[model samples]
Target: MSDQYLVRIEGKNTDIAVEETQSILDAALRANEWLPHSCTQGTCGTCKLKVLRGEVDHRQTPEYTLTVEERAEGLALGCMATPRSDLTVEPLGNVSDDGVPRHPLRDYEGTVVVLDDIAANTRRLVIELDTPMQFNAGQYAELIVPEHAGARQYSMANPPTETRRLEFHIKLTAGGLSTDGWIFRSMTLGERVSLRGPLGQFNLVAKQDEPAILIGGGTGLAPLKSIVQHALVEDLVPELFLYHGGRRREDLYDVEFFRDLEHRHPHFHYRPVLSEEQWEGATGLVTDVVVSDFPSCKGMSAFLCGPPAMVDAAVKALKRRRMAPRLIFREEFAITPATSTAPAVL
Candidate 1:
């Protein structure tokens, strides 16, 4: 018999056919539906959803780390869970109501307007997109370098405006594609390249006097910069504390940019934390500083963008400070080679 199943979500019905191996999240994304997901292997609970009906058998996940009560309530991480029969599921949060774009993988060709080294490990590249692209602040784009197989994704360091140019701060990885391959390392002004994007949901929302905190490490400052600029342009005034951490003074490339912002907005404060700097400034792990500075982040919302270790540390630290888990948003930069086809476990 042909395998088929009917799934209902938020009062909408759709048919799904599984061949005993496909995950629910994969099938939903394949159908052009957006699901809140990260680390698609079940490390992160971003894909957690309420399994309203039918049974599901989830593959062993490194961090399926759910409470007993939570598991009893039919909650499953969609990335690892496979539907056993017809089902209804409630997506964790407010996902895009409409389906994603038909071509999720967009190709953008553009000229390099500006290319400069922001720091020893970071380079800022400005690309003027050939086509008009609209993306929320704190989002990212993937660049398909010439003669390379896998694309490199970077967050926009600037906010979206009517302008056609996009900026990215790329951290050079040794022997990594795009960065080590000399495409970005050897880029010059007015050069041409291809990119695709506007991915991620780490953008800010309109709120009245909400207290906000931002934590970043190394090049993770890219998306945080976009978020701050977006708020400034939109005139959304919120109490913000931005903590940027690096190993040395040189790694804290855009400290001046954020310092200027603090000067402009009295409600904003920028803290630069250097782990290995020889200067007399805030020093320690970025999250360690955040936790120490704001011992009780009880009523504030937070945004984090950085390496996996940093993101994980921030989450743990915030939760310990009595911050609401739902209020903390994050975006992680995943850079990997095409040769290693390891499945991303969220």
Candidate 2:
């Protein structure tokens, strides 16, 4: 038998060759078949698909994400399952004609230019790529962590226009192979690293008319910063409000930067909320502050990024204020199983 098997995407005229050791999602992506996915790991169930035929090796698929019953029912996570034979799989999510632009995945080499401690346990990492990567604001890149034989995903903090230079806000995770073990400890300036470009579907929708409220927690502000910068530059929305939440003042970074931005744009507002520590700024849970600020979110859109609990709270808050379900977009920052020792932060 051939080492490679042809996998067909049900309902689409697409057939991609998948190596026995390669993931279905990875092979489909390389073949320019866009599948709904986040985390690119087995953690998120976004890439779960129905295996219409053939068998698969569900390598490293977490039981919490894909249960035994689901696997028995022919469901497999595209990101973790490797084809055992020729297969036909159907993505559970709809692949629609949404106007969002999809950029092909590519590898790039980058050198660390600036690495500084930005917040309490967060660091600002700037990498200058050899070639410009075209990506929508709020998309993320995966840094290859060869040391642990894995990769860590981080959103681009800089605007999409700054294609050559990418900025990432990395919160140090205890015992994390990419954070404490590498970036924060032994990594140095001018060190070259390999990374893949422009992953994730979370982004500022093009030509949106409703005002946008962006909420972020800790380093989750990275992608929201990119979205805010791009939105303000392009005037994509009528108004923009950004709320960065932290447990204390030490957890918040880039306060002055957003303040400066607000000062220049009359339609833009910035609020920094602290939950654990009392400050002159907005206090209490970030989602609570948003609720207090906006009595009605019926006509506005919201973007949220943070830990699962925070994101879940924000979503509930927005829905309570009558925000349409389709208008609310969120990205929950989480560490994959490989970095299980780390805290749940982007």
Worst 10 residues of 1 by lDDT: 337-346
Candidate 2 residues 95-180, lDDT tens each?
A: 77688888877778999999999999999999999999989999999888755557788999999999999999999989778898
Candidate 2, poorest ten consecutive residues by summed lDDT: 337-346
Per-structure clash totals for the candidates: 7, 0
Query: Per-candidate RMSD vs. true structure?
Result: 6.0, 3.1
lDDT tens digits, residue span 195-222, model 1 = 7665555777465465889998888998
What TM-score should be assigned to candidate 2? Answer: 0.95
**Backbone clashes, candidate 1:** 7
For candidate 2, list the clashing residue pairs, or say none: none
lDDT of each: 0.73, 0.88
